[model samples]
Target: FSGTGTNMFKEEGAQQGFSSVTKSIGFSTDSITFGTIENGHLLLFETSSSRKLGEGRDCAYRCQDLESGRELALKMYKITNPDQRRAIFHDLYAQRSQVGKHERIVSYERVIESENTIFVLMELLNGKDLFDVICTEALTEEKARVLFRQLLEGVQHLHRKQVIHCDIKPENAMLLGSLEDGTANLKLIDFGCSCFKEFEADSRGCVVYDSYMPPEHVADSKLSPSVPTDMWRLGCTLYIMLVQRPPFHNDAQTQAGLAARQAGQLFRVPEYEALSPEARGLIEQLICGDPSKRPTCDEALNHPWLGLA
Candidate 1:
């Protein structure tokens, strides 16, 4: 198995023993009946070369809907073992439960689980994540305002639905459409870590990105989740957009120690002194030591930093 699968299978009319087909570049897959399509085949991308779209544990591939002829992204998970298969089932349940078609969130198509793997079909986005875009290109304060406002809008939507994105970060914000022009747009992706928590109530910070966690997150295990936690991460994200680096004690060498230090201390970006006072003010309130003092998504949207006040 060369990581990326060709999905070798016994052809429909073979002797069922000795298989000798060597199609490496691309492979045909049997159609699946799910979501709004019946007998729809998610065709492996037709490429001149073999490739996979995403990296790490979760692998995504370009796919097509045979019924509507619409292109989609297929996030595939190989069921290597029984444990992995059970875990995939949990992930699918969480993903489908918390996610749907929203203007700010990535549009979820459907999930198809076969004997060997599970496929998550989603809308195909053509752009880079916010972290990469921020680092590579110089983001003016005004541009940051536009993007951060959109981010807050997404947060607002999630909050309205009582959903908390446990892993909210710039890396999870996918930028697309009008990015090259004066306006900017984004869609929040990766809902696997999202959860439905009671509004203004605490929840277990079970799934989280340590770097983006608020100071309270480290002080008291699971006592600092729900809405405030997401607001804190949004503060971190906005800081990265403007300063082009993570806020607070980010250069602490190791992530574990960094998270520990972040709970106790907070640092102001030296270069951020050049940014607008409103911007600094918002970040300060968002990263306030007390999670209870942090603003809600709607409150953040009204912050003077984004000029929506």
Candidate 2:
């Protein structure tokens, strides 16, 4: 741990219903330190460099409680610019507030804020993301159905709460466990771009995965995340789950190739055609270029292809 603070103690108190009794643990001038406490509780403290796992600006560490033998993931975000720090903190708080008890969303355990860095404690997803799953295996119809159903449930939950997951993509959905459990348990994660917007302000800015964006989003840069926008991305995800690739293939080199492809290309539902007619019909309705024709979450839930009946 490199960014621990006295805040975790206060947070623990607050969560235990002691809102007024705020106490600070001792702090170090150097990077915070994390270790296991004697009572078996994992103590995540801050350290100077925090253990570096991989590349990227995010700093992370693994802590084990000496007493309990429990482990935890501690992440610290180094805040340089005050404005950017505020924005990131705001986003984190908003995400925490919006998804209070949603099962499909990642749970926010606690936040540690110091002068130079902020630490967010979250549930570490154990399985691979949907992106890796798709890249490794050719999804069978049963597998696709199971995953898409869970994805739809998550999207529907967000819509019902009036939150738009601006960035919907394979990389953002995590597989919870093995796919052999009759369902490919999936969890929708990453809300850095999610927003709560009024109907009038819905069309302000484009926020989405480029390959999954709809024609309207590509055509109008003013489009904001909404039910339809999510649907379009869901369509793309389903297409990928079934076909092992996006409907429109764009090289990583092109800046606007994905948007261009989304704007002009026609996607033939190859995966659907190989499945039952009901499944094919559902895919057709979902991937329709015209946003008005796309099925809403509720409608999709009720679709015969889902076997919801």
Candidate models: Cα lDDT each: 0.65, 0.62
Per-residue alpha-carbon lDDT of candidate 2 for residues 1-309, written as tens digits (9 for 90 to 100)? 232333433332211111011224564223444333325544444334334433444434653333455555455555566445533543454445656357777665655454454555566666788998999999877777878888888888888877777678898888987888654578887665676553225435436545566666666676666687788778777777877767666642254654544443535556545767776677667767677778889999888878833
lDDT of 1 by residue, 102-169 (tens): 77787866554444545677788888889888889878887788888888888888878777787889
Clashes of each: 0, 15
The TM-score values for the models, in the order shown, are 0.76, 0.73
lDDT of 2 at 83: 42
Q: Show model 1 residue runs off by greater than 4 Å.
A: 1-49, 80-91, 198-205, 250-266
Query: In terms of TM-score, which candidate is strongest?
Result: 1
Backbone clash tally (model 2) = 15
Worst ten-residue run, lDDT, model 2? 13-22
What is the TM-score (0 to 1) of candidate 1? 0.76
